[model samples]
Target: MRYVVGITMDKRGRDAVSLALTLAQSTLTSHPVELDLVHVIRGVPPEQAVSKPEREFQKLCLEEAQQWMAKTHDLIPKTIHSTTSVHFSDSMATGLIDKATERPCDLIVVGAASHGPLRRFTVGSVANALLHSSPVSVALAPSGYLPPSRLTRLTCALGMRPGAEVALNVATQSSVLHDVPLRLISLIAFDARSGAAETTDAASDHAKKLLVRASQSVDNATEVMVDVAHGRSIESAIDTLTWDEGEIVLIGSNRLARRQSIFLGTTANKMLRSLPVPMVVVPRFPAPESTADDDISI
Candidate 1:
């Protein structure tokens, strides 16, 4: 598997590298894991000429970026193949997305926004932009995150939304590829008591049907578990669920997103407030209209 890691000169950047390393180490595939560590800097337009002082400043920035990249590269174990580069872009998110697309990477890994609680994720400008526009799946590392000894499980946050099945498929494929257990989770949040039971039950039933579909997609030896978490809000519902030390969450983009693109929905944004583990936001896949037949209520 190939991962494009957005590296900065801060703790958040180190946190991203840590999470990426854990993923690389835990993958069970025969092919070697590769990491592309990229650092983005503000660069003058190719068509524009620069003054001597501006040229000197640019040279200094590049040298400093390369030095930091070298230090970050040394942190990765020799077992994993890795490379470092300095990219020229006005936007950090844009540069990372371009790198991921050019490399055809399986995922883009980045750290959480800096100003957040120690163990939780706060989406910053870069992550927010990537969530809405990245071509590939984007992984967010929580603040102060450290790599676990190994990944314990893979969880798919299944909902009645349009891209729910796409998220399920991606999570299932990852579980099979990495030889990890898969968990299908449905989160129910209700505001009033008027029809909470009916709503919750209907959601649970739909999740079970999705579970059955996921079971059919995997081999007999693969273990698949399904459960539903309920609360007054999405954050509370997420809090009710138990998470393993190395478990990662996978969720799909909103229906409004362009086909095969990512757009973070409101539910996911709420979940992030309380999510202690890393989360991967997947892009919506192109499918027929009939695909949402069983999930029309939501």
Candidate 2:
């Protein structure tokens, strides 16, 4: 499956490119895989489609994106199919979804806007829109995150009691495309990193068993590992592992109610805020079946 990661000059997005590069390298380890990194600049709003400044800004955004791409020419691979385009749609999120569909990408990764605790729930109006609307799976990168690893070592937070098989499936599928191994990390018991080291060690042990169970259930074809980690927060335990320059933290989103608002999961949010590594947030489940032109047949 082709991996499509959406990136931009936005703080979090810029770092996500590093994360995307890590995933790209992993997938291409044996040979080569199709990797497309896209940047979508918002067009004029429908009501003001004719605004002169809007058009000018659009042009500037595209030009800047191209310039940035040129500067990073050395770091990015020549084998990977990389391209940039200007989308003339008023809605940024819509433009992104439209692009993903055109490319028929199997996975989509993007970043959450930089908003404070009070406003994070409503980040990137366009990004949030796509989350609830896109057809294929969508992943969100944490804000200002930079990975210390070159591979995608997933520390999935799925529980084993019930209603968590879906997460297991997500992790396994990711292992296939990422070509990076996945470790089924379950947060057994965590208080704070301030807690005793013994407590954290025990939690990591519990997660290992869950990973073993996951290993047995999924296709044992790929190189996957399972471990249980603990932290003052789930994020800290993940940090305990050694992350290379291109590593990433893939996470799942938490449900936000009507009045509760939309936001990244607790552990994910914390990780994003503190870590420099790139991370991806996989939604709880797949997008609805009915989609508009998600994959054009012809």
Candidate 3:
């Protein structure tokens, strides 16, 4: 799998790099994992003409970007193949989208917005743009997140929605590739207006049926666990579950998304605010199947 990781000269940038490496290394597939470390020079197109002084300033900026890239390059170990480049575009998100499209990468990784609690995600402007516009899946690293030796588990948030299959497919692929366990969770948030026992029982029964259907679709060899989490709200339901240090969550894009593009709904945005681990937003449609040599690019 090839990944396009957005790089900046801040803590967020380092956090992104850390998560990308952890993800790349965890996959034990025959196909090699490659990372394209990219930094964008926003509001500056490469071909635009300018005065001599302005040109000099742009050159200096490019130099600084290259230096930063070099430092990031050193952080990557020999086990993983990586490349660094600086692109000029109107916006950081635009540059990243362009780069990912050019490479036809499998995933794009970025750090959460600053000013959030450590180990939690806060969507920033660039992440918001990608979630709404990018054609590929996007991964967001929590603030101050530092990946463990490698990922140990993949938890897919399953719902009785149209795009749920997409999330399961991606999570299963990752689980099989990494040889890790996969957990399927159904969040049931009860209301005060209803009979608590009846509401809980009905929701639990439906959630269990969904879990059975989902589990039957998986390979028998895969270790799967299913649960129905109940709470007053989605956030509280998620809090009731224990999270592992090396765990990553997978969630599907909204059903209202374009055929294969991503659109983060209100529920997902809320979950993002409370999630303690890194989250991957799967697109509405499954990625096209291809061999490593044919479709995978730098």
Candidate 4:
């Protein structure tokens, strides 16, 4: 039920915002829920800030947030509710994550500020900061992105540490809520340092046990499939497969740390950079007291 999105309060943020709500609606369509849209204004540097212009910009940003919230309420069907916020911070993504953690949303949606799908490189991987620090799932909407009229399924990136249980729980909820099928995949993992002994029958047997338990936990009535691809690296294996249209990928964040900041490590950063499709990075577990709507988590 908790969902958050980080947006830069600038001139170009309007479209990114529109896409954010629309993405939230599209994802939560079947379930019918509200979203908490957090906007952080990282004020201009002192040298760049003129008293009048800075004041004017702040005023305008507040006005836009007010109008945007009104527009969201007006445009989105009445079933869903929205709580809009505008705050000041020096760091956009990090500050938003702090607010989101306190509020404790199930997922986070971010709008891409960079490239297109056609480019050879990652057209937009700007959500890396949020993916690393967030205590919940993060969703990255593409630039000029539009949600499909109907959401068929959500794809998740499986990792070893996060385990399969949490991601499946959120996915199943979305599946049941939106009336869509669920696709569960265990991206075939290849450990470079893995020994030939580990790949033997015992390991496969143990893995089978985990996957079986994983499937049983989710109340997924949708079609499900397991894939095992062969590749030396994660990227190589990932590139070998094709991403389905309208698919929303779910990922999990690292465990909570004492210090808070945006951006993740190299592996996660690479994943975000290489994959052009939308991704949702979930926080590993519940967070500290300060980050939620009702101040519920202590």
TM-score leader = 1
For model 4, state the Cα shift of residue 264 in Å.
4.1
For 1-298, candidate 4 gives per-residue lDDT tens digits of 5566565543224435554554556644334445666777677533456797787787777677677666544544556677777766677776676677675355566676655453112423335565556555566665555555656566655544534444555565555555555555444446668663454344445445555654574535555544543356657767877775566666545434323222344555556656656666554443444243321110
Q: Summarize candidate 2's per-residue lDDT along 66-119 as a digit string, tens digits.
A: 776555444567867665555556576677677767854555666667662321
lDDT of 2 at 127: 60
**TM-scores of all candidate predictions against the true structure:** 0.92, 0.64, 0.92, 0.70
- Between prediction 2 and prediction 4, which has the larger TM-score? 4
- Across 103-197, the per-residue lDDT of candidate 3 in tens digits comes to 55788999988776899887899999999977888999999998798788889887776668678767766777777888888877778886778
Count of residue pairs whose backbone atoms collide, per candidate: 0, 19, 0, 18
Model 1: lDDT to the true structure:
0.83
Best of the two (1, 3) by lDDT: 1
lDDT of 3 at 31: 60
RMSD of each: 4.6, 6.8, 2.8, 5.5
Q: Which ten residues in a row have the lowest lDDT in candidate 3?
A: 289-298
Instruction: Give the 10-residue window scoring lowest on summed lDDT in candidate 2.
Output: 289-298
| RMSD in angstroms between candidate 4 and the native structure over all alpha carbons | 5.5
Better of 3 and 4 by lDDT: 3
By descending lDDT, how would the candidates be arranged? 1, 3, 2, 4
lDDT of each: 0.83, 0.55, 0.82, 0.54
